[model samples]
Target: MKAKWRIVFLKEFRETMRDKRSLGLLLLFTLMYPVMLGVILNQQIKRATKPEREGIELAVIGAAQAPNLMVQLKQKNISVEQKGPMDEDAITQLLRSRKVVAVLRISDKFAENYQAMRPARVELWFDSAADNGARQRDIEEVLHAYNSSIASARLLAHGVSPATVAPLQLQRYDTGTTAARSAGLIGSILGFLFFPAFICGLSAAVDSTAGERERRSLEVLMSQPARTWELVTGKWLAAGALAVIGITLELFLAHAILSWLPLEEIGMSWRVTTFDLVMVCLASVPLSLFASAVQIAVAMNAKSFKEAQSMLSFVVMLPMIPGIAVSMLELKTALWMYAVPMLSNQTLLREIAKGEAIGALPFVLTFFSAMLPALAAVAFATWRMKSERYVLAV
Candidate 1:
């Protein structure tokens, strides 16, 4: 019986390989997905490491009123562009152009107020719509420092202590690292990597089942000495074998790309070594089998190639739902997540990428989650194929 199934398996596999279109699709996805992911990640790293601002450009109106302040701004690496006094409309236009981070307008009574030892005013003009918050904050810091210096000098000249103005001192500490910040993004990226299992062998699965039936050859094949289970198992393995090859190659290519790139530039890390990746690929083998089993079971029920293709399109999207829902809910990982097939694989890979020492339970659960359902699907397909309705239709 094993020999019979092996013969059937080899026969189906040979026929699938003979179809150049199916071979091309399998090869394309195996290469395309990893390359595309690598390109996207590279772009993200570049953007994250790029400098926020080369220099904070500030527009100063009535610059002569506060030459000392202008000198202080320049000392802080702020570039100042002098302009005559302008109305609100002109200031708005200047900010919209993004040529300056902000406008510093010295009040007309600035010099008088300074000499009189009275309060002075300055209007800070900026466009809230622009992405200049960091540059604007830098400008504000320089202005505050200048004001504090002036206040201290004036207080000392008046025989008063400048320390009385500030009763409290505060310091800020940030505990978040780039790796921590990048974990969520990296998790999302890894979630999509396993999706090829559902796509790579779709054409082969549909063609072997519905295409065979539509071509009126299924009835003749069923008349052979092999039992229904043997025939179903052989076809299932053939399709699953293609999915396995495609997914395995894809994972290896993605591993190479990730390891070669400097993911640290964006606070992300790919700590998976070659041996770890090999283990992941081994654990993921059942996912392709499960995907193919489900596809063969569903597609065999369709009457034609186009019909099978259409129905399986919706079926292919089913695996992605769990991953998307988990992301939307922002749920933390738990033991139960490892029992959910596609989600389990995604979570396992994500945790592994984080360099966590998750013990063997996740690997066991991930393997069986797909394996159990795959066996059930193949059994169901075999039972369905033995029915009088399917036989009559064939």
Candidate 2:
């Protein structure tokens, strides 16, 4: 003989499985995040592996005035296009169009200014909001080098050492490793991978509770011999089971995509091994349960499916707030982070991705953080269902 909750679990699970629309939503959420992550990372890898200055195009308003500058730009593999003198408005439109990395406008007085040993006025125009900072910096470096060379020549001709005007020579050495630099980027991605847990279970959770109520079937179920806790537990488990499957598949797919990509080229890595991933999946199980439990508790209060969905839409996004806040503030990883459900899973995965051998405390904290909340939600839902007002309203 099966327990009442087990019977209810099987029944709700089968009904949820039978809804093609529910299954379709589950599949979509499960695949969408991993695919998005893969595509984004792939683009980064492509950009990183591309040759520097391979296809930089620069527009010069007066190319004839600075033949030496043009030669230097060409030598650096930058293709320079000559254009007639343009006003600031024209240059701004050109930059907005993004046809060139930047525009170098040489003043008509450049030749006279150079001959008279006055500072030449050259303007570098670009869209600061555009993603061409690196290319713009390259062009600026060439201009700086040309200026230095001419300065050195003038000093030599005047019987003065070029070093006389210089007091310090500076060089930079970066101590941060590739993995360290890429951690924030990878962490942001990992944070969203857990999003499917909330989405995949949402329809099923809402349908099994609020949908049933809207159809007036919930009253009949409530009147059954089964206790309120049993019914709530069964529904919670069914929704949670779907969430678990969705998140697990998403994580594995993400792992496959990240592992196959040449992340090393971009100073990023997915250092989680098979064993580490298995542990991560295990620790994340409670997060899915927590999502389902919270959804069930919240959805049961709504008078109809539409209302429940509108409310849970906001609820689903609530978990991401903490993670985003932490990222925005650039907070350091600490043990307390693992005590916050969604953030815990994100931090744990980030640590593992950085090849850290974190001990069992994070896993324990992650598990219990969500697990306890889940149990409390289930309890609250059961108590809510058993209330006189709830029964009368139904």
Candidate 3:
């Protein structure tokens, strides 16, 4: 009986492998991930790693009052190109056309207040879109250093020791390993990290069998004397295998690029481990099954392939909905979070990235949570496959 089941499973696997789309998507998973992510990460790194330079078209709309500040900016290598008296609209246009990095509009009282030793107001206009922020931050840092230097110089000029201006030094103590820091940053930026394996398997799984169901070939297979569950499991495993292959390749590609590429030029850096990848693949198992089972069940009820495909695109893309939040929100994942199918997988993968031991409780609950949905979907799909109307209905 067992041998017969194996025969059926292998047959299902071999049959699905024949379709070009199934084969391509399977291979694509293996190849695409590493290539795509490597490119993106390398670009990010390059942006971040650009050499620092000191030249920006700054339009100063105030009087030549802050000679001290101008001297300070000049000392920092910033070229102070004062654009003679201009209104807000003119300055706005200058910024829009990239005429200047920042337009400093002084409230005519700037000089008077400087003499009175009072803080004066200044409007700095910038086309933040083009600024890229990094340069602006450097400019700001230079200005801050200038400000501190002047303040300390004045204290000494007033007969106060420079030490009188200094209070206490603040230092950061990072007790964790390098991996933990890298994981925290990576988790925030690459929220889509853990999804490829599950999604790749999901599409192939649904298409191989459920797709065939809608195409009427599945009925041909069902009409044959093959055991039902054996046939289904065989198909499921085939899709799963393809998914695993694709995901592995993608992981390799992703790591190669992220680890090797010039990422600092693009304002990014990343690191991932073999262990992190294994956990991702491990977590992907249930999701792929659930995705396949849900689609199979849905397609089982559909009268046509088009209907099934239309309805199931949502199911196929279900794992991607929370993508923005996953990447941007930086929320902490607790043990109870493992109860959520996709979320748990991400949490465990993140832990594995940090070389932290995932507690057994979260492990069981997460997979079990995913298991519930998968079993229900499989049960419904199995029962539907057994029905004569379901098998042959128009």
Sorted by lDDT (best first), the order is: 2, 1, 3
> Candidate 3's residue-wise lDDT over 1-394, tens digit each?
5665567557656766667785776566556655676666655554554324436556777638677777776676666787688877888788888766777676788788756767666676777788446655655776678567767777787899888756877899968666676667666544455555456655555565556766778777777777777676666565556555665566556666667765444433454566656656666667656656666677677777677677777766676655455556756766666787777766766676676777667667766767789778777777777878766664
lDDT of 2 by residue, 50-135 (tens): 43735788999888887888999999999999999798899999999989889999999999999898999999898999877677
Model 1 agreement with the true structure over 1-394: per-residue lDDT tens digits = 4588888899889998898876887798779978998999987766554324367789999899999999999988888999997999999999999888899999999999999999889989998888676667778898899989999999899998888887788899977554445556778877778888998878878877888887878888898998999989999999999889988899899999988989887666777889888888889999999999999999878767898899999999999999999999999999999999899999988878766789999999999999999999999999988986775654
Which whole-number lDDT from 0 to 100 does residue 208 have in model 2? 84
Mind sharing the TM-score for model 2? Answer: 0.81
> Which candidate number would show the highest lDDT if scored against the true structure?
2
For lDDT, candidate 1 versus 3, the one ahead is 1
User: How many clashing pairs in candidate 2?
Assistant: 0
In order, the Cα lDDT scores of the candidates are 0.86, 0.88, 0.65
Off by over 4 Å in 1: 22-36, 52-58, 64-77, 84-105, 111-177
lDDT value, candidate 2, whole model: 0.88
Model 3 scores a TM of 0.72
- Ordered by TM-score, highest first, the candidates read 1, 2, 3
Question: Each candidate: RMSD to true structure?
Answer: 3.7, 3.7, 4.9
